[model samples]
Target: MSAPDPLHDLGVRADADGGLLRLWSEHATAVELVVFAADDLDWAIDRVAAERDEHGVWRARSARLVPGAHYGVRVDGPAGPAHAFNPVHTLLDPYATGLARADDGSWRGVALAPLDAPADRVYEAAARPPAPRIPLDRTVVYEAHVRGFSRRNPAVPAELRGTYAGLAHDASIEHLTRLGVTTVELLPVHAFVSEERLVRQGRPNYWGYNTLAFFAPHAPYATTDAQAAGPAAVRDEFAAMVDGLHRAGLEVVLDVVYNHTAEEGRHGPTFSFRGIDNAGYYRHGVDGEYFDTTGCGNTLDFGGEPARRLVLDSMRYWAGEVGVDGFRLDLAATLGRDEDGGFDAEHPLLRAMLDDPVIGATKLIAEPWDVGPGGWQTGNFPAGFTEWNDRYRDRMRDFWLSDLRRERETGSAGSGIGRFATRLAGSANTFAQERGPLASLNFITAHDGFTLADLTAYDVKHNEGNGEDNRDGTDANRSYNHGVEGRTDDPEILAARRRSIRNLLGTLLLSAGVPMLTAGDEVGRSQAGNNNAYCHDSELTWLDWSWGEDARRLLATARHLIRLRAENPALRPVRYGVFGETTPSATQMDWYNADGATMTIDDWNSPAERTLQYLAASTPETEGPNRILLVVHAHEAPTEVVLPAHDGVDRYVLLWDSAAESPDADDAPGAPASETRPAESRPGERVGVAAQSMRLYRAEGAR
Candidate 1:
């Protein structure tokens, strides 16, 4: 009907003999494919002229373009305000499946032959099985770095430590399986390079956000053998890791960075996108200045079809070929911005990702914001995508940490439990009713901020090591140090911090939304007050396997809380409850004050009234009918709460308590499921809630 899109198959594709190469550049007057010697990348063996089609795609084919051959493209184009095309500059193919560094310090793309049988196929043939496809409601995500996760693990082999294989190691799988997280959201594994500035400063971009190539896995993260074996081997290792995790019933979710590129500012680098089509690949002002929304130098121009297709292709490769279960998009708001740079809910790229058959079926979670204007789009993503709820993080922290600090310093907490309760029951005011609670990926602490332990132990961020002279990280951490900052020998302070950790973990795992736990938070890992530890690949950022007494206790408590959440269907509602009607999979919640009486509007807003009781009953759809009562006290001062009397409930069994030093006995880390059964109490029974703690009770009713 119409001219076929030249962007289709825009990379090297193997045929029966040689290979076909396609390159896209609207401004390029001439394009040439340069093949390098296999042994010496710096030496060019041949240059083949490429013929341009009507769709601006330049095509060429050569027997030398077979697998393992190194190549790059040279484009001749008109230079102007928005364009940075250079005829002499050697550029990488945007869709390069593999990349390599030459001895001369330049980069080239390695041609990969189409797999006769995909590695995932071979993996399947081995009967490794596939992902469990854990339901969204039942998914508990554990966010970790592939390298940092196993770097310090004692059980992982020395050579395998800090590699993709390390994560697939039996010990690592066992640890994750034992921890009870259904999904593992790994930080970026895309091919990335340290920022020019970070490299010059003798530091590296530890988080791998500076993506160089979207389709390729970071080769350095693979084992030495894989790295020596080449890109295809690296990819095989990555696939094997996914297969291993899948066999363990763990879903692997990649944290992808499509918003920006490693080719930073105009003067930064002449890599793939920049040298190929700078203006078309990056968002820029009228004067050719970059419109940097990602705060990472250059933002990818999602407004262009080529750029959008690049992301879609990358996603399809990972989801289909690699067998990952999901993706957590970094700086996702940038992907939704239109040509005019305004945030649009129905941007073509966003819609395409949600509608694409392969990617749409997988879980898509958005970080939902960038550093640009109108950046805070927490609940603004479309129906199919779940967004990281920063509002929930702030409110929970404020009520538990900052509010408690205010009470100690100003004689009154700054806010009531109203906002906290909204998040607890699911932020109906934020997310659309159709999207429901699952749309909210609720977490109090993420990789970018303080750990759960730091949230209770640090009043200020200590980010001097980031080379920004303590000016880097966000000042508004919303954290309190519990009378002393950093490490403290004070028993009272230590006990208070432990209680705060329990409360935070309890709230997150018990909340009515998808929960994401930062990897080492369960073990009380701290960045030593450094909220922004993105530059540190050392022990500071790695998850330490060695656990102290407090860390062990906290880990056990976390496991117990996660288990409790799985057992109680009322805690995880699929939909928001209507005020006067029963909705399937929705939780009908009733609010009460310390006196067990219904809460008044005044009580909800009063700063002095910091204690409240919540009773939730689940309208069963797939699970049995369930009811639970949660008591929340937000002040340092102890309070007595009267358990609310519900129509169908007769007695309440104590399920979990945050005030307990350990979840079980002092000697035992986690209490057995049977031992967690405390004495049952009748309605109106008074229970002493310790300072700044939460308690959960399962309501048993007379049938």
Candidate 2:
């Protein structure tokens, strides 16, 4: 109300007016902005009664909104779940970039006028600044939640554990670096509101997917020092985390949920955007009713100009202000829908992301589909973007799990060598040549589903702890428990599971496209059967640093596989070459069966043939210095297959064998197993693959 008011320094800035604050409470009979002294949290100097407009908006102009000032909004009105307006309750401003929680869990908003805080200066002034933007071609993405990644680590300090600074600690970085992923794809870190049910149960949304403020980092993940610094401090800490990751040469990609907000239907809380402009921001039914796309209450309507601006502005803020290297847009198809409800690949929001100069270099990946009608847009995204390849997930699962189960139980294999070869070579059939192989973001496991370990250790999803009566999580998991369900001490069963993990990892790393590995998958982390650990914040979600012998072995195997992927150009193909003929700069991938002959159509559609040999030779013009051959055997029984002995190649080398207790040293490819394959061999003379495993070979001299 007077000169030097923190509100003047902290409030929103406008060209004409110095600072401004707006309240979005339609049911409130009265609303007042209460500004408090910085040092004394309990006392307030004055209250500014809001001026309501024709649209029921309440706003006040003042220069007192500066950093360090404490404030809250006191609204007088109705109270209940559907009608949440308590005049006695002094609510924290939902738009407060900074927050300080009181003893009672209520927050004191930061002083307002400082829109141009110190944190904002550092972000806008910094140039290139060494942020790691790993190319999708050579990327091995490790998906994780910031808090869950460090919560269980003993090496990280107790107080900092599960916080943003905690994740940037050397202990966590060392673990990820040792595991060998180029990018750490973090789950949603945007500010979010916990569901009332979760709060009552004393549980928080561990995944943080229900975003409340797209521009603000969730304050809980910040350290005490950061939290005390207010919103500016939280922003600085987040930027510092990105700086640390970039210094370590690891890219930071975010799993963004722009499809929906924390607002749950019409009954949800009045938080941020929903309270700011509900009717204009959210998509609704024909009669200006409820939103139906997200099933999670409400979906953001990208159909409108103002909504599109909000989305584009948020994206730019994260990419430029927060300094994220890339983004994986959740339920992206929902963002492409028009007012008439038709999805457009060239939607204005999507186009702006592709063309925005400030953030154009940032990697753009789409979850590709939504729960809406005509939502399955798999390979339909425009060029310059990548998509999560769910088809590849199912196919790979069927190849190693379901197919191997059929082989063991019925003494007959399922599926073919040809289709398996396509997945290995980037699933060109699914993505066109123009969009190229990078169009596919391939993965066998994701955060929403089972880990690679569980994919082979559990046949059915065990999600009893989710409190959803097992109705939650996906049932079409395409998994195989491999002889025994859950944990088992049986030596044979344990050995099979290990091999299966290696096989899956091998397939993922060896496949052409951008590969995303779920956090803890490298070390064989399990959710104890809970596929959707969205709410459980304990060990169910944390990455366990202390691992057993099998987990350690899997970690080593994963590292070796990632190194192999990085070194081999053939494995990270950006373009889809001619399948039947040679194409420049692209390797011609060939397929064969146990009988040592080219695969036919019958071999593919048949649910009886599970073994395949994959041969890839670079085109003569663009062969460069890398060439290799990879073979896969998806069977329970030991099978001896002859090498092709192509006219040019005389011998081959063994680079890796998933069946081996450990990865074997390099060996020539085409030569007989007894001759060139000189690594530790099993009792049998044939190249034996413990059921549900894969192996890689490199071709040498020409015959």
- Summed backbone clashes in each candidate are 0, 47
lDDT of 2: 0.74
The parts of candidate 2 lying over 4 Å away from their true place are 1-11, 14-60, 69-96, 100-128, 286-288, 579-584, 619-623, 664-691
- Each model's TM-score? 0.97, 0.86
Give per-residue CA lDDT, model 2, range 114-160, as digits (tens).
Answer: 32343545334354367766767778889988988898899999988
Question: Residues 482-523, candidate 1, lDDT per residue (tens digit)?
Answer: 998899899989998888888999999999999999999999
Best by lDDT: 1
